[model samples]
Target: MNKDHYTYRVTWSPEDKEYIGLCAEFPSLSWLASTSQKALAGIQNVVAEAVNDMEANGEPVPVAFADRHYSGEFRVRIPPHVHRALAVESAEQGISLNRLASAKLAG
Candidate 1:
């Protein structure tokens, strides 16, 4: 496993009443479950699926996650349109856009 591939963080959500999982390195891969343990298990399955799919398609698997966890931060500049969309989403979900964005980025 490469040490610089990608990492993710799983968080618990009260409104949704589930444990949400996300991987920023794999932006499209995420899952949720009723419990943290279940959510982590689900994440493992999701990762396996992603790896299997990538292998079947002859794509390189992202093995960095196996080496170390991500623990750094950076900044991004979102367009106004995207910011508005995120704000609307945050309002509808009853969560702060900052939290949502943090979760998304941590993933």
Candidate 2:
């Protein structure tokens, strides 16, 4: 897979005084540079080398988030007491329990 298809994040490091680039799909790899662009490029090069090494060693590369599918729905179970409290609160707010729960979880 091409490096462009992978996820790259560049964040400032106060301790290091430089931008740090990390690849989400390749969690073990990172790069630090003076500029965000250089950090990103460094991480991409690292990922390329890692991919080549893995292939040479017959190891599999990770699939990035861009290649995955998310349903945006999941099931969870909570205690009965919490459920009752949320239901009452949702009723008082004049909104469905699902909406209330979603809002609470989001924020």
Candidate 3:
């Protein structure tokens, strides 16, 4: 959420049968998935993995949006049942739902 960083939109495309993810400002880093949530999850996982891999290999992580900016928000709508479960689990762990989701996905 840095002001100088860029944000990407990950969306579902039924025609492609996959989630379509791409940075509006960085077109080269695009990916796809089968659902909107999955696409968002995939992009986060892929980006984190890529960063970790680069760090492991002693390579500099790419910074395509060092000075770029974003104004829109990204939304990933989960089912009501799933949201309830996440809320319960997050409370049990004493963490916010967003933190819980991020930790689960990062793992």
- Best lDDT goes to which candidate? 2
Q: How much lDDT does each candidate structure score?
A: 0.77, 0.92, 0.71
lDDT tens digits, residues 1-107, model 2? Answer: 66588988999999999999999999999999999999999999999999999989999888778987898888999999999999999999999999999999999
Quote model 3's TM-score: 0.44
Per-residue accuracy of model 3 over 1-107 as CA lDDT, tens digit each = 23124466877677887888766444566678777777766666666666677789998765656564665445789999999999999999999988888888779
lDDT of 1 by residue, 9-53 (tens): 689888888898777657787789988878767776787778778
Q: How do the predictions measure up, each by TM-score?
A: 0.50, 0.81, 0.44
Model 2 TM: 0.81
Question: Worst ten-residue run, lDDT, model 3?
Answer: 1-10
Q: Higher-TM-score candidate among 1 and 3?
A: 1
Give the local distance difference test score of model 1: 0.77
State the RMSD for candidate 3: 14.3
**Order of candidate numbers by lDDT, starting with the best:** 2, 1, 3
> Clashes in each model (backbone N, CA, C under 3 Å)?
2, 0, 3
